[model samples]
Target: MTRKILLLSVSAGAGHVRAAEAIRASAALSGEALEVRHLDVMDYVPAGFRKLYADTYLKLVAKLPALWGYLYQSSHEAKPDSTTEKIRRSVERLSTRPLRKEIAAFAPDAIVCTHFLPAEMLDRMLRQGDLACPVWVQVTDFDLHRMWVHEHMRGYFAANEEVAFRMRAAGIPATNIHVTGIPIMPVFGEMLERQICAAEYGLDPARTTVLLMGGGAGMGSLDTVAQSLLQIGGDFQLIVLAGRNVAALEALQTLAAQHPGRLVALGFTDKVERLMSCADLVITKPGGLSTSECLAKGLPMILNAPIPGQEERNADYLLEQGVALKACDAVTLEYRVRLLLENPAKLADMRNKARALGRPDAGKQVLKTVLGQ
Candidate 1:
């Protein structure tokens, strides 16, 4: 236990990295005095291998999602097929050469893996007597896929109660699943005083402020939402996060030019927590990280077009649980925003409900489980 905790993640999707960092931050805040390192497992693989990974796997998931879900489901219903499993094992062996070296150098008490690529590889090595470390796989999404569960893994950190149940349904033992929620930014747990936060955002003290993000990639319906909000002609102001979507950012800038004070558009930045504190209602897709942030801060959402697969599932889950409101389409989305913004009573009620679902101590909860505290 004297050695530091090693956190494993990949950069393909920013969620994995964010999840790993959350645990690292949790450990630091818990007074563990632990050194934390977040490493990408794919970095150990060959360049061609990584490219194939991007081309074959990540792209498919992001684009043709239904097929990706089918493949994911196949992993769940896997029969006794050792040929593919052997290939899987062989590729894992190939990657773990660098991973093994790093783990030895770091000498961690436990390995917290946010992505499956490393957990499967590292766990295989440990089980086959090539490595010795307790590997913990943190399922970064709401659903449980087989890649996330390995025989040698010591435990798991899941995002919600439903995921924990799904893990159990998938034959993973109930004891191994820990519902820590999704560890978002370190700023999530920071309790910003609302009035002060509003002042900092230059938001009106009396009128509501809406924060919108389309994930880190910043691809969402912000322009339409902004235009419709103006149509409603409410006294409220808008704060839009166009994360890394430069075109969208530019477009919003042009829109803001027409009514400068009413709209503010920003490129990818790390100030979402401040915006969360300022906003009365937040319009966003149901990305796990964004959703976790909104929940932790007790911000209600006007959930819109969450694609299909994981996002769709997440949106439905939140809406069903009364944590958010789902707008059927763009029309409903704009109307929901105006309706929620105008009625302070309804907005306050929804906000309080969302806050009730917040586990502000999610990081602390996961840290205790990982550190065996």
Candidate 2:
């Protein structure tokens, strides 16, 4: 019998949607009898509410990150009492009407939720006896947030053992959690030679290359980082991936024009893996998907200005792993980059640690665990 797998993801961040897409691709390559489908949870919601859900989140993170951080912590610390349960039920029913309809039509044998919103809704449905399929929640962060927890989930996938330990501490049973590093496209795991990638990308193979990515929305201070890099004296070139942010892209392009051969500014490109292959170091915000891709490539990282809540936690985990440095300001970022350039040994050490921590085959691992194969 062919197994039907529904991957539910939300677009609050690009990571969740990308993780679902990665898992779908992996399932296709697995040679198992499976039918997999990936759905953006927002697609099912009414347009007005959908726009509000996504746009509000982006505005909050971009404009008022501190408030977002405060809400993130407060929600987690709140006790799950009877009133909490009542409020949860009300919110679940209101928000999950579209999802409820989706489940009926899809009739999946197993449901994998890559985002917390769908997981919370699906978990509530299961508890209320509205849905019966086994639920697997993939926590796509290095650190576990309380929002991602649900006692009814059949399994929980975590990025590392430390996160798994935190899951257990959150009152989830040990047997229900699996330490499968966040799923990334298998392309990142490919061992492509840097020289060849540089040649393909028209970069000088002799010069050290730095990649600065601001996630899909281009939400970070890439211009500030670029300015800092220009002040450093080294045999290094800069590549800025200003994803989906035209303003940032234009600003970077203007900067690139000043330093002809030393800088490259890209708008949004599907060639992130190729770019990563050519980069020795990455200066990026601590988003789960981007960091996981960097780790898979064994590239050293300097985390820059992580958002207050989940990103801060992700930055902390990367620091603990010895694979990354946190630089919240342009001055600190410049100093860290220069220090790494002056000391090749430290950069190499970070690369080695990243390789140790990376799970290149995480997609396959997630499939194997969920399917019991």
Please report the candidate that would top lDDT against the real structure.
2
Quality of model 2 by C-alpha lDDT: 0.89
Q: Global lDDT of each model?
A: 0.77, 0.89
Task: For each candidate in turn, give its C-alpha RMSD to the true structure in angstroms.
Answer: 2.5, 1.5
Model 2 CA lDDT for position 282: 96
Can you list the residue pairs that collide in candidate 1?
A: none
Task: Give lDDT tens digits, candidate 2, residues 1-373.
Answer: 9999999999988999989988988898899999998998898877777777788889999999999999888878877675875686576568668778878898999999998888888877898998888999999988888888998999999998889999999999999999889999877888888889888867998899999898899887677679779879978999999999999999998998888888989988877999998899999989999999999999999999888999999999899889999987888898999999999999999999998888878888999999987
List the lowest-lDDT window of 10 residues for candidate 1.
53-62
Whole-model lDDT, model 1: 0.77
List model 1 lDDT by residue over 208-245, tens digit each.
67887767776656777777767776677888888887
TM-score of 1: 0.90
